[model samples]
Target chain A: METNNRINVERVEHKTSEKMKKTNFILTAILLICLPFLLVKNPVWAQKKESSLQLSFLKKADQSKNILLTVKARNEAGKFAPAPNASLSIFIKSNEEWLLIKTLISDLGGKASMKLADDLPMDNEKYFSIMAKIENDSRYEDAEEELRVKESRLTLLLDPTDTNRILTATVTQTGNDGEPMPVQEAEVKFYVERLFGKMPVGEEFVVATDAAGKATYALPKNIPSSDTLGNLTIVAVIENNETFGTVESNASAKWGVPLQWEKDPFPRALWEPRAPPAMILFFAIVFGGIWLTYFFVIFQLIKVHSETKIK
Target chain B: MKTTKTITPLIACSLLLFAFVHQTDVWKAPESAKAKKNPVAITEASMAIGAKLYVKECLSCHGKKGRGDGPKASDIEKPVTDLSIAKTQAQTDGELFWKISEGRKPMPANKKIFSEEQLWQLVNYIRSFDKTIVKSK
Candidate 1:
């Protein structure tokens, strides 16, 4: 009876071992099948959760100065770090579409800077939308941030329709995108360039832009003309404006009262020729004296010849 | 052989997907725009007036024959749509008017420059490009 019990127990243990081996084999097979999915990163999943890029803007001191921007990158672990050597591009929104302005590379600290060209448009109000973007980065998804800048522009027009010689100076305010925007209550000073320097014109040296972004000054007809063609160099200046820095527009017009030659106050006596009696008399006396000396010498010769001939 | 079988179907599917994606990118007017009827009647006199206005305004960009080959057409970043094409003619007159009144980038909005009646007339003039459509009208 003891031998029979031992055999049964060994058989039961062998069956149990076989069952355990089968279970281990199934688990290993399942793990092997799913290893690639678990270990290898899926691009679709990576795209769903893109990397975050943070951007900040530093306002420029003047509209003519460069605008400063800073960029920082965040890792998948949500840690902020400088994105070194990343490519960045700047763009401005024009008619709802972003127009590329410039491209730059980030430094080791993930900082990038750029400025609008001096000739490009900028406005005082956030009338312009500026965008900064990071491009072609695999480790981090592409990112962009938008900022508003204050850029101002001024344009001057001389009304050609005014027949009354009314020196009408019109000032039009424009934004960075070259859109005419009304600038109410901003003082605009009009000046005419002279041989020496700019001379302020109009009874009111300062005028204000109306609701239509237009400021009209009855350019006093008395402003002296600068050229022979009756052309005047008119300058519309807006200095120390809170919105727009020193903005000025120079325009030429056939307006302004000409510098009348008759009214010229400078003394031209030395250079200008005039038939003055005193000068004419001096010239006549000098010539008369020379002629008189020549005639007397000729008369003496003639008398000596006559005497010699008579001897 | 197995890899070839898999890659062939994959490439075909990718091409089909690409074509489908780009097909939807073409700008299309909303159903609301399609439903709105033209208020102006198509008439020869109106076309004459619109033709004059087109020469003054759109001729620089849309060309004399409405072929999108005007002098300034190349200066714009976006390609000017050929008004003589069937695709342009397929749009309703109201949709054309709306597009002109509320222009997109590289195109100036003419809402202030042209009146509502004038915009409708321009729609008629653009439609006159299709002789069949003109004959039917």
Candidate 2:
């Protein structure tokens, strides 16, 4: 009975070893079949993502000043990081279409600046449309941005003979067809041009344009001019707007009613130093007295030394 | 009968060759545009106005001589056509007017910006760039 039990156990062990070998071979074959797929890379889905671009005015650019366009780029991680060595194309929208004017490359900080040419006819339009674009980047898709340039021309008219010296201004906006159209409801501010910029003319500085795109302001009697001849340069300004940035025009007028205070060269108060004659007299007297005392002291010392030596 | 068969095949082959040799331009204007005639009269004044407009609007992409060698030509994906070339000059004024109004990609539509008279004037201006033809005339 013991010999019969030993033979049965040997048979069971042989069957178990064969089953283990078969399982190992099957797993090895499956791994070999899937190995190529595991090693091969999938298409770069990250590169297909859309790139983002932002445009801003670099400095205090205005209608009178040349425009400085600044462009910034964003990375794949949604971070506003510098896109160094990237090219950005700048375009200006004319009457017909957008014309590519210049191309700029970003610096280490991913900041690119493009200064518009000074001679651009900015007075022709109330708002200029500028576009910046980055095309066919390997890592990022195409990106572009359009920004509105606030610019316009203001025409100032002065009526001097009227009982109420009214300064009238007409605000005009240029259409895409290069035609000037009246801009209604635009706030036009009148200023008297001075050596250091401009001074407001009257209490009602800001007035909105009427239906005919005209704004009027009553000029005060005592506005000062640059010269004695009552010649004044009055500027009509449409201040900065979100759409139409800024526009200004100037007109010369003989309406400057010079103040009596401006005409007088001498100051009325002691603090006001208009080459003070009283101060000059006082200084001369004080200086002369001190010098005379010094001279007297020197003469006495010299006489005392001479007499002592003789003795 | 043999000669007739030979001539037929030769004629058919010749026709095929002719068709291949004289392929039409890739861009085709609408039937209405193709049939229409230019309304604006071509004069020195109109050409002068068109010249100014072209310089301001088209000089960057289309060169001063209409040679498609403007500064921005290479940056654009599509090859800019040389307006001075005979192939471009062969197109009717109406066709050119239609294309300018309804622009393709990369080129903005100019219908809003230019009036019908202005577009017609542009056609005259572009034709003025064909000095060879102008001299011949």
Candidate 3:
């Protein structure tokens, strides 16, 4: 009876060991299958932590001085992620040229602030563009904005009666509702195409418009003449207290008297004589010398022939 | 007689040269008279329309205040634009109108969505940033 009991106990122990082995194998297989998925998902997790960067500008209350540029950066999770080593650049246009005013790094709060020079002369009469840049990993991404400087409205009139006539130009600024806005001082620039060995010249006239928002300027003496004369373009520019206080307006009219094909008489002399006084004197001297020499020679010949006949 | 022959030819050559130079100085019209017309004005009504449109389309990239920090700006590889600079305010109405109509790369043209008048209104709203016109009060 004791020998039978020992054999039975051994068989039960063997069955238990086999079940433990099978359980271990299944767990190992499941881990192998899911390993790649977790590894692949790692980058997506990192992306969520690395994607927050923002930039903005702060306008001063008075709006008279330099403007403050605020650049904010955060992680993909929208948390403030300070990029202490990150580089920042700010550019501005001054005197018709683009100038890099400052470069720095963001602070601990993931923010960078810069002050742009307000005294910089901005010609609002023309179009202006600005750009800022920051490094993102291995690449550089930049933000850019192009704008037209605001200037007052400018009106130019061309006289249709006379070719040599001068048309007056008037400039003023209007409010948001088209009402006359008060402008301390504004510049009205006059320009025309260059023709007949003349380049289009620009003249700047600075004047404060009256309560009526009107400032008048006399046109330059030599206006460009074109065969297809239409409205001559005039530009008015004003840079006020605001960083973006640049505005411009244009007005044109028919230039010179319209010429009829039949009645349009071409000038008898297209070009004014450019001969120097010295050149005229030189020609007169040469011709007079030749005439005197011929007369003298003829007189001598006649005298000699008459003397020979008398002899 | 010999002097007359030389002087006459010299005078004729000079006259020819003068005539040629004078003719070259005459003004001629350009081949085509296609001049770019003035851009439309930006009005307050257009700004109202642009503001509504901004919420619908641009608010995703450009924030509620036209700042480049919109919700989607963070995900894109490119940095968003900042619209509050003096340099930006310095731009002409025409230039701003052109850019909005024919957007720059990365920023698709809004022309497909907005009419020309709406675009002009947007420009006007942008110009409202001028301190003299857009007071905080």
Candidate 4:
């Protein structure tokens, strides 16, 4: 009975080994069949599981625009991995000129992002493009990608009601035929136009446009106007709208109290604290020069008189 | 009535000839000015400068190769003068300089725009397109 049991156990082990060999052969054949298709690459997805420049996201804030670039490479497993330590150059095309804005190195995650300042030069066209390039990479080939964004327009109109002043902002973008098309659900902000910068119109920083691309707000009556005519320049602006980047339109309305700029009752005398610095400097320089000349002449006369005594 | 018919054709022909002569023949340089000598020496450097200045200042109306077929040539009602032909090349260097300096209605005067040396260089560039320039070289 013991001998019979041992033979049965050996037969079971042999059958299991044969089954494992067949399974391994099938998996190997399948991999070989699919090898050519995997090696044949599509450029969009071609990280070589090597390297690629990807525009991961664009963020336009109310007052600033941010552009993000993610550099990726293929790992040993043919999986996408961040290409760290890669150098990147960012360029913005304003009209016909390609201006280099920033050069950066990719972080460990193969990502680099830059915020375009409000003062970046822009043309009057409806669209602007940003390009990123990775050159002379030791491990991966060169990669470049350009992203173009259509700028949107914002215009504000003021209508005076019986008691309340109504201001409306409309947002639009250029369509295929280059005609204005409404950009619905866009956020806009209103500001009281000031000499140096802008003051927010209402308590809330931003207001959203309706389906018709219009956002309306009521103006407070107490806002002071710089001119005597009580005319206030109300500016409606869109900051960093994903589509429109930044645009503003302003209209003047006679809706505020006339602000009288007070002039000093007496003109500031020279050497006074409120006197113009330049004027005080000019007087000091002239008087100092005159006194210096007088002293020089007196010193020369004294020397001549002494010399005459010696003679 | 027959005399009127004959006179109409004769009047039309006379008007046409008068307009043609007014455009081509009326640009006579003063005798003393025509004899003025070009002070700019003829050299490769001058030729290169003349070529550059012509492209910037004159190429819009005068066309490349001085064929008077520039992109802006048609915008003017008056015909652009071809500089390559004998009609223009026959003029002396000083005469060409004066004509360029004192441009007519379709052409603005370059006297304020270009210096005397630059005008002479442009005159040399225009002469470069002439067939005689090739023979002289």
Candidate 5:
């Protein structure tokens, strides 16, 4: 009896252990499927969203004057959310050395503003660098903004209908968005090439954008036609020493209009002057010859009749 | 006698001019009238030949139903031309024969493979696609 009880106990224990093992296996499978979803739903991942940074500066600044450095940060919602304690740095080159001009944390409005002292002697041109950084443990959420001072960019759009003509030009002061910002007073100088082996020269024409951010210029009447039209270099000079905005934008387009011809049975020259005159002349000559022959036969017939009657 | 001779020559010249103009105008009228009288007739034998030829050659590129989606069409860079469109089916028999004999781009010429009589049969089969013929029958 004791042996039989012990065998029964061992059987029950083995069944319980097997049941537990099966339950654990099911739980593990469920967890494996839900693991990715759980990590994505974590709260910390939601707070550290991506941000975009913009940088701008004037074209020229006084040597003793400080350059105003503005940095704006926008979250994924496109709202201006304050990033308190976010680090910002501005670097300007002085005597060929990159010196950190200012360092500050973002304000309540997600913006950092500082005045950068001119490190090098002021000339007609100056160069500077600005950067803003946001720290996050997540590799994907970190953001940085950098600035580079180089040649200004120009974009020209010829209306599709105005194929060969330069309908208008747009000179924009490009910022971080790679687009021109609104300018109240901007001057664009237009130039054209000389025709008939004459030297190419610049013809200055000033155009300003209206309330609707567009500048219109009528192309010159004597636009030169050539096998290859060279590039049109438009130089935009803003009155006063405004250094932060784009100083010039340049663009060029090819020189001829696309011609679409209708299908015709005859060659171009066939229907012009050749056929009508020849047709008229042939009819006139034939009629004149017939008339002359009829008169001659009539005169001969009357003379013969008169002669036969007298005989 | 002199007056009669003068009138006869004038009458002859007028007759010659009138005959020349009239003959030139009517030169191609007979053939055109004959073609109009005998429009293409689609018979079962011609359609059967067309079906056989299509299965042997065209069905590999243009699908069995002429939807332009056959098995070999998947590998080709340019899609096969669909023949079910009314514009294609409305093409004249002569135009169809020319296109088939010369072969358009991407479609190889079948002139050497198909005899003239076989091509005419194919033209008859294509004409069956016209809705007017079915309605009239």
Candidate 6:
């Protein structure tokens, strides 16, 4: 009886120990799984300030492949301040992979600018992506910004259409074969550079590019010119565009009326030399058409009368 | 050397399986990807833009009806999921956007090509096939 009791007790103890061992093993496994989280220095309460990067393309004149990246970090004052001496890794996307172009430390103003003599090899060969990244910072978390810009040109052409001036904005992007391809359905805005600010040229705020990548607006008459020669700077811009950033081309045209012209007026019944000559031509055309019609009708009536008499 | 019949059949089966595996892969989007909401509004203008972009960029593999039966669908290695199917429609806009932006083999990541709003516009366009499925956020 003593032996049986002892055996039973040992069995029970062994079972309990097995269960405890399993429990301990599971608890240890759980701790091991969460060990990385616990060991990490940047916890939820002690996280660093987040950094932000902004990228922009600065196309020189009507052509050039130049890009500028801006990096900022939220300072103690909770404002975006220039992240000086920050390492910025610039990458271009090609073949669905990020090709690191260069790593340039940002200047004091947080501007990292670079000019590419040739276009980067893009996936589609037309549109390209430039990504800027600032990683592994001590005081700030990692940040990345990407800008997708299509290789394009904005041409501003000022032409005289009859007595009025027509401003044409053409947007062209590089095709697969490295030829100029017209971009359709691109929204373009026309602006006249005024002394105070930029004055929108057409009545409509935005005009979409046609199949030929052209948007034309007839310059309104009597716009005040900056100088006596009636020359004003007209700018064609594709502002805040997804494919094309704020691309603008300026051209000088004699579309605006000189201040002297605006003041002089006609001096005689408010009709000038140019207006009377054009007005005389207009009236002459109307009278000439009317007389011709009347003469034709009378001639037809006389012929009908003669024919009836003969019959 | 194996028997002629067994060897030929085994070789053929291996090639077939290889092709099948490559063509039929369906990757799952992460939880963060599923939680994304469509930022582009579902309006006539937005849908129109989406339609135009779809025709230009996604028409090759997705097909005219988004049925994954496009002309190039067979040529592509990855299985083109039918965009109009209920399985696809049940997914959130962000999930679709994530899949498009971060593609696998034979499917290029479109984030390099399109902007954020433009990808949302594509999601809106894809949603047009079945209007009843998507609940706008």
Which model scores highest in lDDT? 6
Task: Choose 3 or 5, whichever is better by DockQ.
Answer: 3
- Weakest 10 consecutive residues of candidate 4 chain B by summed lDDT: B67-76
Instruction: Give residue A35's lDDT in candidate 6 (0 to 100).
Output: 94
Better of 3 and 4 by DockQ: 3
Stretches off by above 4 angstroms in model 4 are: A1-128, A132-146, A160-163, A176-179, A263-311, B1-137
Top candidate by TM-score: 6
**Fnat measured on candidate 4:** 0.00
Give lDDT: candidate 4, residue A153. 59
By the lDDT metric, which is better: model 3 or model 6? 6
Give the lDDT of residue A65 in candidate 2. 42
Question: Using lDDT as the measure, what is the rank order of every candidate, best first?
Answer: 6, 4, 2, 1, 3, 5
Q: lDDT (CA) for every model shown?
A: 0.69, 0.73, 0.54, 0.77, 0.54, 0.79
What lDDT does model 3 reach?
Answer: 0.54
Q: What does DockQ give for each predicted structure?
A: 0.01, 0.01, 0.02, 0.00, 0.01, 0.02
- Give lDDT tens digits, candidate 3, residues B30-126: 3331132336555566677767666667767766455456666766665555554465666556666676777766778988988877777676665
When summed lDDT is taken over every stretch of 10 residues in candidate 5 chain B, the lowest stretch is B25-34
Runs of candidate 1 with Cα error greater than 4 angstroms are A1-163, A166-311, B1-6, B43-45, B52-57, B101-115, B131-137
**Which 10 consecutive positions of candidate 3 chain A have the poorest summed lDDT?**
A59-68
- Residue-level lDDT for A115 in candidate 4: 79
RMSD, one per candidate, in order = 33.8, 28.6, 33.5, 41.4, 37.7, 28.4
- Of 4 and 6, which scores higher on TM-score? 6
lDDT of 1 by residue, A217-282 (tens): 776666666555678888777764545545667778787566556565554454556555677789
Candidate 3 lDDT score at position A183: 52
lDDT of 2 by residue, A1-311 (tens): 89999999989999999999999999999999988777667544444443345564322213444333333333334323335666778888878488898888767755676666645534354456778888766555577777776545577877767768888898776676877778888988888889999898877799999988899988887877667688888888776444665566788878886534456666655776554677788999999999999999999999999999999
Give the better candidate number (1 or 4) by TM-score.
Answer: 4
